[model samples]
Target: MKIIGFKINNYKSIGSTENFLSVEPKVTALIGKNESGKSNILEAVGKLSFDRPLSSSYLNNKNRGASGEVSIIVHLEYYQSELNEFEISQANTSISFTDNRVVKIEGGLSELLNDDELLMEAIQCVLEMNIRSVWGNDSNRIKSVQDYLNGLKAITSQVYINHSARLGNLKNWITNDYTSKEDLIEKLEIIDNCLTKYYSLLPSVYYREQYPQLEASYKYDDIKNIFKEPNHIFNRFLLAAGITEQEIVEAFEDPIDGNRKTVRNRIARKIQKNIEAEFNEFYNQEKIEFQVEFESRVFKIYILTDDKAMNLSERSNGLRWYISIFVDVLSREYKNKSLVYLLDEPGVYLHVNAQKQLLELFLRLAERDNQVIYTTHSPYMIDSRDITNVRAIEKVEGGNTKVFKSAYNQNLSNDSKMETLSPLVQAIGADLKFNIGPSTSNNNLITEGITDYMYMNAMINYLAIDSALNIIPSAGVSNINRIVSILIGWGCEFKILLDYDKAGYNEYDVLVNKLDETLEDKILFVSCNEEVVKEKMWSNPQTIESLISKDDFKKLSTPYDGSSSSKKLAAKEFHDKVVNKEIQLENETVSNFQTLFEAIEIQKHNIAIVRD
Candidate 1:
């Protein structure tokens, strides 16, 4: 079973219904400022995988005042086949069979077959009478009954099939006549044994938690001992790296006393090659090599860079932290077993780029069908392109924590919550600044906000244009002029694509008057106005949201409920649908977007020609 999501209640800093948090299946990131309860969400989620009671320290102070029960409910998704297996396993344990000998008796005689002494005596008397009657008149009938009884005895001799078949026969006999009490109890015991084995083979949920303290130490002896254990995470790493315990022991064993350490050197080189191969997939850094040596009956790890070797512990804090945690995770006792991994602020000490590499590792692990839930405030850890994965946590009134799907609800008006949302805000701002701010790329498109960037990029990719343009989003239309001024000062060639509404027009006019005439051509508006768009596309106001087809527009509008913030949320949903391909673009809508791309491409071509 995979955990789809979960709900938390009465946990620390989470008091009431408003304090609950929802988790995503693959990689759920809990992001908020310090003391905003991001870690609390991770802690609560960890509690669900195991039957552990909440520590008294974690009980919500606010809820304790009201005597509320602290609980967490996890929603799981599994195959019907698993349920069938469990049921079949349960049924196998309760199944019973009877002795085949009892089933062969004739009906009139079966009624008198309760006690062992009486039944045997009656059967012998019937056999003697039948034999005498059939001795010369019906010898064939006598032989047939004898053959049937012999076959039943032969079947009962086979141990594997005998017990169940015997139980079945016993059950059938019990339906007609009472059986011996000892025989009935013996048959029940047989069923119990079958069930015990069946239940043992059934699958169960496995949970593992990796705390930061586990990765804090990297001493060679400690690392070596960890690899010797079967279930240690480091052992898995070594196995994945193509090293065996026997080989490790051999490397430590010196065949020659002082012969340049040939065995240890060869193993270390092999390990280095494997380590580099594994780490390079996620980490972008200078080529790293490892050296393993046995000194004073202990193994030491050294890293080689620039032809110089340094102790592994001497590496940067970020690299050391990453390596330690990576080893710990990879070495998990149940790494191969299906499990839900709960990581709390993992890689917190890593550099921004290393944290990003750590995110890549999380994705790789998740691809193996395991779910990962982690908490982080670092923007690098958040996939900005897919903000739907983010769940923002904040402290509300009465010291309660609340979680929000930030991408689903863009215009969260509560200013008090904004402080807690600073990490996400900074993440988006960083993304914008990195993509469109002073850089080598000359072609850039600046839009009003995330929705515009989303729609425009989706259109650009859908059209498959070859333009080398980077799309950036200003906080809003009011902020567009400041971004334009900054780009102009940087001597960066950029195009301003704005909404065709009054606010957008006002911003465009103000920006034009502030900049010189030379940069005027870089500014443009979306193709259609409110009146023309309403007549052609069946939507009003001519905003980017209106560009979507009527059907999608209706779907987006369902969640708005006439609230201003809800309208912004609806726009976010619209953008997500368009980008995720959930909403099919109408031919007319595609044509309109194609026209926009054509305009931007033509502008880019003209600017390139001018520069040439």
Candidate 2:
């Protein structure tokens, strides 16, 4: 299941964080400056998959109920078994599931309280727990506690291995303690004590060194087995890169059989070759190549150099930092068969060109059906056209995280990037290009499809006295509003002639409001009454061609069927409706050259003279 979007409330400095994610492009970059809470977003997503403690200390007052309460809504996008759209929103500390189809465990801390009474009861129960089991003999109270424990366990069981930070510690504990004759708690306590003693001197360390094997039990051995499983190429690469080559070879030499060693060797060789080819290609393209082979067996990595990839250790920092995170990322990639990557500031160390390469790599990964969640501060990392997908993340009142998105247009031309984006301090954030107009043009008109624009233009010219107007066809109704705003911003007067229908009216009203209230003057809306057009103009085959050929008033007023009444009726209606709407002088604050009503009245008088 790929997470498409999520929001976190009452979690750390984030009182509320709501934003959508790009799931189609497997690699999503969660980019922001240091302390912009980019890492917090990753933490929030991780919490969705696991019941890890959300850091709530940053909330104004930790004493408040909000401190311990974390509300996270994770949208998972997956193909259903039937291959249909399957999306579920899982929310924490909320009333009822965002998706009702998903069930909630009873007596859970984050209860799916469908009613107010249940929520109140759950709150009351929470209060009672702090008072200590005063009535030790209370069987109902004991049962409640037991139920709560069971529910909590159920939640934990669904969590994945990426939740834990201390990998090494878990691995050491598993290797030393398993198979010993001791109770589970005793064994755990012994392992914890060892970790505590070792961490006393160097306290930052957490996680087991060995991969944690997760299954029906939370035992260290259980996780270790999965981590040690040679099938995972990522884990094997991690092991090969971390351990001495001789040691890795020795581990699989005798009892383990040559097959496992052969596979491990092949995997390592493949990784080495891929890295080498990528690096060489960097140089062959006239880009620089940066490489660092750590003398120790702990880690080894290569860096590609280019104009964008300047600064080896100082600017880009060593590849080790990224490599360090890669172990976790790669492991999680395999552990969760369908995993979404959350990479924050991945190419900070790489040059601009290298960053570009990384983005291309991510695009390829996306094609492979892997969801990548990546963030970048570099514009080079982002596709200029997919600007709507870009979300501006900022700090709002009460230290909450606020997200702003482009509602009008999804694809942004490179030239319009700065204007499209509000340029917030940081934003963690694609679409089709409808070729309505040349990208180079500052002034553009977008309408609803080619046919709509064609008919609209025909109507305009037929009623026109004289005007410098450009008519453009659009992909659909949705595109008209966006194009109008852009044209208006560039000091162009535009009129949208759409069918008098629901979808057309909705777009018309929306654009009127967004563009500017006074746009009614410069921007015109002309709608053709479909029924009238069908009965009058479309009924006679020769009539349309006659109207087309006879551009002058005298010929136009002359009836095709030699009937004066039909000609007069068509002239009167066309003058009253279509011509009148285009030149209405409602918003006098802005001038559309001449009043449409006045123009239509003039045309009517002329037609009268022609008929007489």
Off by over 4 Å in 1: 1-4, 20-25, 50-67, 76-274, 332-342, 407-426, 429-442, 464-467, 474-493, 502-523, 528-539, 551-585, 602-612
**Stretches of model 2 off by over 4 angstroms after superposition:** 16-39, 51-68, 80-270, 273-332, 405-612
Cα RMSD of predicted structure 2: 18.8
The TM-scores, one per candidate, come to 0.63, 0.40
lDDT of each residue in 1-612, candidate 2, tens digit only: 344455556555556334433333244444334455556666555434322323333223221324444555544433332123212233322211222122232221122222224333433443333212221345665554444434323331222122123222222333232343133224334433432321121101012223222111122233245465664433544452343344444434435567655655554565455444443443243544433332222223344555454323343332433333433433343332444555666666665555555666556545534566655566556643232234444444455554433212223333433333322111111111222222333222344543333333435444453433344544357766665656555455445545344555556567666656664443333322223233333233222113222222333333234473354333333333333353221222011212332322224332211111
Per-residue lDDT over 360-399 for candidate 1, one digit per residue giving the tens place of the 0 to 100 score: 8887776666667777766677665455566777766566
Could you tell me how far off, in angstroms, the CA of residue 475 lies in candidate 2 after the best superposition? Answer: 20
Candidate 1, residue 319: the lDDT equals 81
Per-model CA lDDT versus the true structure: 0.55, 0.39
RMSD of 1: 15.2
